[model samples]
Target: MTKLTGRLDDDRRTLVLTRQFDVPAEQLWTDFTDPDRLERWFGAWTGDPASGQVMLTMNAEAESVPAVPCRILHCDRPRRLSVTVTDSFGTWQLAIGFDEDEGSTRLTLRHEEVDLQTVPEVGPGWEWYLDRLTAAVAGEAPPTLEDFVDTYAPMGQDYAVMISGS
Candidate 1:
């Protein structure tokens, strides 16, 4: 696995993050694209990326995770999905690709458009969220953002520091 690293440029205020997860790409795609499967890992899911609708709530069995209205900017199955999230001043693209490794899938994610405004929370918060995602794909329930909000706040700044090539 590689330490996730990327940068923002003068032309773009986006922070592109990539991470490799030991999971199958298709399975990763399912968890990310399919609402039913997504809820198993995501605290809340609303709609289907495959269907071009937002899956903001996870399972009907789970409490509704609020949905931020987003437009599907790109939906390349088993590869990429770009969505514009509300409360977020940027368009985020989530890309899932694979490299075969020792009989497991190395799932890489690229989250684009994380500018000055988005960088703070997305960095450190991503640590917990990505951890939850890894677990979700591994068939476990993910901890809610509510469970780690306070902890992530200060730490996220530190996270950006580390990510900024320090």
Candidate 2:
């Protein structure tokens, strides 16, 4: 598993994780922006992104979940994407960055304004979804939710410590 980091930026809590893929940034960009491709790993979104908002239905969840409203804050094609999603849990500000080096792409996922107490569960959830993205990119079966919970649930305290820096 990849390492995760967290910080307090302007008094707002944020968590960041990076994953490297042996593929060009273009491929990863498509995987991130295309609704059909996103459905394979993350979720499928509806509505025109140009409208600055979309309804994203997360299909990878273990059980049925309601779609969330995602507001696009910024979109720099093939480079960065920033959005704020509001769901039953709360509001999540997410920043996604794509950087390419030596034909490999490094994807950075940053969640801003996170609640300190939620880091444990939130951290592993993002990692699990990213792993699903990796599997989709490689045309492999995604890891099961049971496996993720079994393996990473215990590490919640670790995430909490890493984010709290205590």
Of the candidates shown, which would achieve the greatest TM-score relative to the real structure? 2
Candidate 2, residue 13: lDDT: 73
lDDT of each: 0.57, 0.84
How close to the true structure is residue 161 of candidate 1, measured as C-alpha lDDT?
Answer: 73
Q: Give the poorly placed runs of model 1, Cα more than 4 Å off.
A: 1-12, 43-51, 55-65, 88-103, 144-151, 160-166
| TM-score to native of every candidate shown | 0.66, 0.91
Candidate 2: residue 100 Cα off by (Å): 0.8
Candidate 1 lowest-lDDT run of ten: 55-64
State the lDDT at 98 in candidate 2.
94
- Candidate 2, residues 1-166: lDDT per residue as tens digits? 4444433455547778788999999899899889999999988999999999999999977799888999999999889999999999999999999999988999998898888889898887887888889999999998777858776565677887776667
Local distance difference test, candidate 1: 0.57
lDDT at residue 38 of model 2 (Cα atoms): 95
